[model samples]
Target: MRVTMIGTGYVGLVSGACFADFGHVVTCVDKDPSKIERLERGEIPIFEPGLDDLVAKNVKAGRLSFTLDGAEAIRDAEVVFIAVGTPTRRGDGHADLSYVYAAAEEIASLIDGFTVVVTKSTVPVGTGDEVEAIMRRVRPDGEFAVVSNPEFLREGAAIEDFKRPDRVVIGTEDPRARAVMGELYRPLSLSDFPVVYTARRTSELIKYAGNAFLAMKITFINEMADLCEKVGADVQQVAKGIGLDGRIGSKFLHAGPGYGGSCFPKDTIALVRTAQQYGAPVRLIETTVEVNDARKKVMAKRVEAVIGDLAGKTIGILGLTFKPNTDDMRDSPSLDIIPALQAMGAKVKAFDPEGMREAAHLFTDLELVDGPYEVAQGADALVLLTEWDQFRALDLAQIKNRMNQPVLIDLRNIYKPAEARAAGFLYSSIGRA
Candidate 1:
């Protein structure tokens, strides 16, 4: 299949590269000439685990290319994928679909023959209909089928997820579009990957509903961690016990600052807005969004509790990105926690293996350091926000000696409380006494 992927953000880039790896000729189109130039020069904008290698291999094999001209690629493509960002709107919390619609309009004018236009971006329900309407309005003579095919790729494990998705959801009633989509994913189909064909609206809702539920689970565990702390119980044990049950899986059960990333925060808020717009409000998800937002500041309070007076303290932070293996800082909990700490007059020195460059642009007052030990040097307390592998098994004694006060606050629960205590440090961890 000759595929043209528009808007080469995380979704577009990854999906395009993976499709190319599947032996499809893929051209990733972006409006930004600089981003397209970077891709053409063998530079990947975002950091994913195996994406650089995958893109390199595919480009070397002549199956993948990058372009700034969507018309050039769409004219020769069988499948045109709109993988643009559907960020939360400024005031309404609804998904900003302007980019998706813009891409649809451009594709409507550009596509030559019958094309299966798939919305691979996470969008609100009925967005496919709007996209189809936009295409028709722009070019009434256009022959294209708008299909909702939302992506489920995680940031860190996007390559693995794309190559071996648990299920592929294709939302379109057009038989031609279905056949084209099926052929596009035939490589995975041969491996028996489940491909669910559903109504367009249901497929769009599935993406939002799945993200909202995961966000709720994370918030639930975070609240449980708070309760466990008050009641002298361990949330980890609770999570383990309940996770063993087949009904409730263990994924996203870790108690941390909160859920913050490209998907959860925006998607959950968008879902709440979308549901309320139709008079079927999801109060549970609304509460989830509230709790998660408040949890970030609460985490700063946890650090404050350990440090006492924050005015003249120099706190060492171990990670800046939302999670390990990805440099995305869209709505990272650190964005909230670091700022809150600074507002209270605590100077922060942070280190993240991949996130420092982006974090530098976001933070102005903090000092970005080189290594974890360097960040810990002369700091009052060491706080672990993102559980990077480098921070997992650090020299505890060395860290304790380097810090001004021998304090360790493990928000990720990566260290044992007993071990930290044995290392002669006052330790604070989530949900464990």
Candidate 2:
């Protein structure tokens, strides 16, 4: 199948690249000229494991290419995928669908015929109808079917997840559109990945509900960690016990500062707003969002508790990205914690293997170091916000010696309290006594 993927953000780029790797001809379309130029030059804008290699190989094989002109990409494509961003709108918490709408309008003017236009971006319920309406309003003469096809790839493991997704959801009423989408993903049809065909609204809701549930799980564990600390229990042990049950999976059960990345924070908020507008309040999700937001600063305070206060302190942050193996800093917990630390007069130095360059733009005031030890050197306390592999098994004694005060706050609970105590450092962490 010849496919045109609109937008080149994380989901768009990954999905487009993986589709090409599936032996389909793919043309990635982006409005951003610079991003398209970078892709043309074989420069991947975002960092995802194995993405560069995948894009390069596919491009070299002539199965994949990129362009700034959306019309050109969509000209002869059998499937036109709208993978544009739906960021949280300012002050409303609803998904800002302007980009998606804009793409739809542009696609409206150039709808050839019998093309299956799939919404691969996470969108609000009824967005398929909106896209359909936009197409009709603009073109008023051509026939194109809009289908809902949301993405569910996590940042760090996007490549693996895309190649072997558990299921693929396609929401469309048109049998022709369904057949087209099915044929487009026919390569994955042999991979035994279930293709769920459902109503458009249900598919859209699935994306939001899935993200909300994951965000809630993370918040639940984080709150449990706090309770465990107060009640003289270990949250890790608690998580393990609960996670043993097949009903409650162990993934996302780790107690960290909070769930922050490109998806959860904004997605949860958008879901809450959607529920409110429709008069169905999701109280659990509401509290989860509130708790997660507070948890970030509380993490900084957790570090401050170990360091006595932030005033005149030099604190080293071990990781800046929300999670490992990606350079995305959107809605990262570090964005909140670092600023809170700086507010209290702490000099913050940070390091992330991939996120430093992106995070550097967000944090012009902080000193970004090249490595873990560099950030730790001469600091009063070292705070591990994102658990990068490099920070996991460092020489604890060497790190202890580098700090002005031998203190470490493991926000991700990467280190045991006993282990830190044995290393002769004052260590404090979430969910452990």
Candidate 3:
């Protein structure tokens, strides 16, 4: 299938590259000249594992290409995939559909013949209807079918998720649109992944509901971790107990700082606002939103408490990203904690395997360290913020040697207290004695 992918962000780029890899001719269009130029030069703008090789290979094979010309991309394409970002709008907390809408109108203007316009961005329910309306308004003669096909790719493992999704949720009212989408995904269809066909609105809501539910699960575990701390119970064990039951599966149950990233924070708020707009509020989602917001600041306090006094304290932060394996620092917990620490007159030095360049702009004053030991060098205490894999096994003696005073606060519970205490360090971890 000849496919035109709009908005070459994480989703658009990966999806385009993957579709091209699957033998479809894909043209990824982005308004950002610099981004499109970078993609055209084989320089990937974002850091997704294994994407560079895949995209390069597809481009070499003449299947994948990048461009700033939206209309040109869609001119010859049978299917137009709108994988643009739907970031949360300011103040309103609603998804900012400006990009999605803009792409719709652009595609409408150039669309020729019958085209299956698919929404791969996570939009609020009924967005498909709005896109359809926009299409008709822009190009009165344009014949387009809007299909809701939300992506379920995690940042670190997007390609795999796209190739072997648990199931593909496809929402289209038209049989021709469904058949077109089916043909587009036929390569993955051979992989035995179930492709569920549902109504457009349901498909849109599914993405939000799914992300919000995962955020709730993480928030619930965070709350449980807090309670476990008070009651002298290990949250790891509590998570294990509930996770063992098949009904309550064991994912997103690992208690840590509040959920933050490109998706959960923005998507949950958008869902809450969407529900309110529809005259039916999701109370649990509302609470989840509030609790998670509170949780970020409380994490700052947790670090302060562990450090005893923020003033004049030099604290080493182990991780800066929202979570490890991806360099995305948007809505990261460290954004809340690091500044708070700095506000209290504490000197902060942080390190992340891949997030420093992205996170550096967020904290201009802080000293971005070269490594864990560099961040900890002569620092009063070290805080394990993101739980990167390398931080799992560290030389305790070396860490002790690097720190001024050996205090280790394991926020992600990556280390045991015994080894730290044995190595002459005061060790503290979340939801554990």
- Candidate 1: stretches off by over 4 Å: none
Query: Looking at model 2, which ten-residue stretch has the lowest summed lDDT?
Result: 298-307
Best by TM-score: 1
- Which residue runs does candidate 2 get wrong by more than 4 Å? none
lDDT of 3 by residue, 1-433 (tens): 8999998888999999999999999999988999988888899988889999999999999999988877777989999999988888998999999999988888898988999999999999999999999999988887889999999999899999999899899999799999999999898788888999999999999999999999999999999998998999999999999999999999999998788889999999999999999999999999999999998888778877776778999989999888888899989999998888889888989899999888877886899878987987989989899988999998989999988999998889898778779989899887886
Estimated TM-score per prediction?
0.99, 0.98, 0.98
lDDT score, residue 281, model 1? 96
Candidate 1 residue 428 C-alpha distance from true site, Å? 0.1
Residue 189, candidate 1: C-alpha displacement in angstroms: 1.2
Per-prediction CA RMSD (Å): 0.8, 1.0, 1.0
lDDT of 1 by residue, 157-240 (tens): 999999999899999999999999889889999999999999999999999999999999999999999999999999999999
lDDT against true structure, model 2: 0.89
The lDDT of each candidate is 0.92, 0.89, 0.90
TM value for model 1: 0.99
